[model samples]
Target: MFIQSFLLLLAISFLSAGRVPRPEERIIGGQNIEIEQAPWQVSLQVNGEHICGGSIYSNDIIITAAHCLYEKERRLEAKDFLIRVGSSLWNSKGTLVKVAAIRSHENYNSTNFTKDIAVMRLSEPLNFTDKVKNIPLAERNPAPGTVAMVSGWGATSIYPKHSYPVHLQGVDVPILTVDQFSISAGSNGQTACYRDSGGPLVVAQQLVGVVSSGYKYCDGPTQFISVSDERSWLLNAIASIKL
Candidate 1:
């Protein structure tokens, strides 16, 4: 059964090349969340349209999937992107911040999404409040099978573009070992999906992973760039980039 599922996922992965998240990708079986539940969550938007999810790492730094910016080859200027923070819904009122710069891992390989991580420098420092704050980064990976919480504004189903959620959605999913996750298929309810690319995977409120890619629709397994594994790279980027 696993083999068959793997084959099917392989085909879908090929069909959906490039790490772009399709509209069909979303939170398959998640529940709506309260507005201030995740103060660090941010919605990444391009041309004013909600595209991917992200998380605030500091007053001026946000972490997300590299594909969120690299899907297009052209260099992105700070003006081309906007980040919505302090809101439960993607389109609802929030603190809109402009991008000052975007830096993706130098070794980011789009073909297989290796090192698929990126950080954005906000144009200005965000004022911290109960509804807007940064989340701590995980110092190490949690043990396998640990339950992690993932939240996002992706669609609620695999069907056509379900209107963007008016409220954020969240789900608790168990962490699968690298071996088990590597062979897994698309999201199966509790996993991240296309709309969730660049979303944060948190364990005990510490950011541990960044959503990279998932199945074509929304089921089975999802892949995340482990934040703990790339801690050095992230710290270097954060330090090198001046506010």
Candidate 2:
């Protein structure tokens, strides 16, 4: 299972990079932002338990990682998941979007991470407000070397096991060229890890990547499933569904 998991990580690590900076050291001096701008950002819950994170694309449609929906032999059922949107804190009451349907990419083989994407349809339209709104879909492919932003209520550091952030923690990372990401990522290095699955990788305020897998420590080289890389299939899937 470990080797299978490693290969799965490697397949997604097709891109390469050089020695990357740690999350804290790469901070931008910008003011702390609220989760409203990226209203689609959400905390995924299974049986009222926080399992991972995700992003909302439409009133009912959400995009997340395939692996997040599958844990060991326990694949999640629609009824078992709930999406909490617009709050930086977990316990805060926010719009509860019950997943009505889940669609994993047809090519998504659990042993590989090449197509690690999934969509969740909500039972009803989320009430858009200052605290909740949808994230804009990618308008075009982001250029390589573009810096993107990722936020989650995960750990603040890679080590020293600490409590999860009360407010969402944000990080800015440059998009690694395909060659750079693939090489530097290796079998293990720096990448998104536990609790970050299905999170959004935002570029210019648009959804560009989905959090898939990362290194064990939760810091180093982060690996994200590129949204632009699977544009055609995503478009077709979105079009086929009724908002």
Candidate 3:
């Protein structure tokens, strides 16, 4: 059971992109890029409060971190969550989709930070707009050193008293080899920070990964979940839920 759970968590981690270390150089020039143009971008809310980030892969489905829904003593239900698509700021009025079902990877072990992926089904289909559209999934394998982008509403600087950014933040990062990331991230460090999970990692207009986990310091280049690595699993999961 332990092994199964670990593997499940690893799968989720792969789906969610947890545990990225901050890069030494900060990206400051592209702050004006509009997030509204990214159709998959989503803001995750719990009990009517925006707490995290996610992305829409389909008209009725959104993906996010398993840890986002898991409390220390209890697991969250679909009824308690909502997804807002096409919103740049959390306070913006947008289409609110209530979660109808939640499917967390079976092997998920929240404590281990592996297999941290979960999919939430919306109660209704979302209307597609320039601000909201589906991001194409990557069918080919991604190589190390691939250039990609990560966006979120996470803090911009690491200070005990620093204020978290209210607008979405984005950074361009290179995909490091898995072995390299594993060593740098430490054995137990395998998850992205607040408001980053389930965000899209786009490369050449293809959705290559999902923003999962990263260092909280915001000091190094961020890590991401490799979506290309688990295309089959994601497709199967999506099919299962759609049917």
Candidate 4:
């Protein structure tokens, strides 16, 4: 039964890949920014390739979406990944560090996309600088109208004409609810694509959301995992590691 379920889920994932992009892929109608402005932003890489975005939580901790820990249907280990921080460009111009451990939320549900949070522990502590800083987590949900910002190196558009930018891009968006944000308006008909998942959504200098997944197209608002909603698990995830 477990084997059958796993196969079914894998089939669904392959079928949905082209249509349904997983949790916040791209940043449309965004402007380029220096890494110092959003010092917490970090890149998750495998073999020098930027796979996803993450944020600096502390000297040795990175926070990202739980799903980002997987590549396609295969689950990845901590040693399989490297983290790049303090860079405007995803591929270059940063400090790439080794990951010692990773812990995903125990209740993470890939089917319905719930509790999509994870943390990575670095092998060595990051040397915090003006260009490398940690952002605090949110204690409560933002009001519906609160404007937040997102930054990443994900593809700028979902169409064939679009290409992923080397520099980090950012855009401002309004909150829709506890787990939703509006890209339907000023995004200029732009939607997320690949490589942008697991990025931070900041409001008032605090991380309120983690880009989790998105639609087949820009048919509606994008869904991000609520940090406050999973604060209990997150706090435990962060506190459990002695390093």
Cα lDDT tens digits for candidate 3, 158-241: 234323455666656666655311211111222233556566677777777665554343343344455656666677887888
For model 1, the local distance difference test gives 0.73
Ranking by TM-score: 1, 4, 2, 3
Candidate 3 lands at a TM-score of 0.77
- Model 3: lowest-lDDT 10 consecutive positions: 180-189
Collision count for each candidate, in order: 8, 18, 31, 6
TM-score of 4: 0.84
Per-residue lDDT value at 129 in model 3: 87
Candidate 2 on 1-243: residue-level lDDT in tens? 011233245444532354332445211211234776556678887766666778878777888878777755577788888888878665576767788888788887665466878888888888778777677767465666677777666545433343355565566666665431121121232234456677788887788787766554444556677776776767677666554
Candidate 1 error regions (>4 Å): 1-26, 71-75, 160-163, 179-187
**TM-score for all models, in order of appearance:** 0.84, 0.78, 0.77, 0.84
C-alpha lDDT score of every prediction, in listed order: 0.73, 0.63, 0.59, 0.73
Selected candidate, larger TM-score, 2 vs 4: 4
**Error of model 2, residue 208, in angstroms:** 0.7
To one decimal, what is the Cα RMSD in angstroms of model 3 from the true structure?
Answer: 6.8
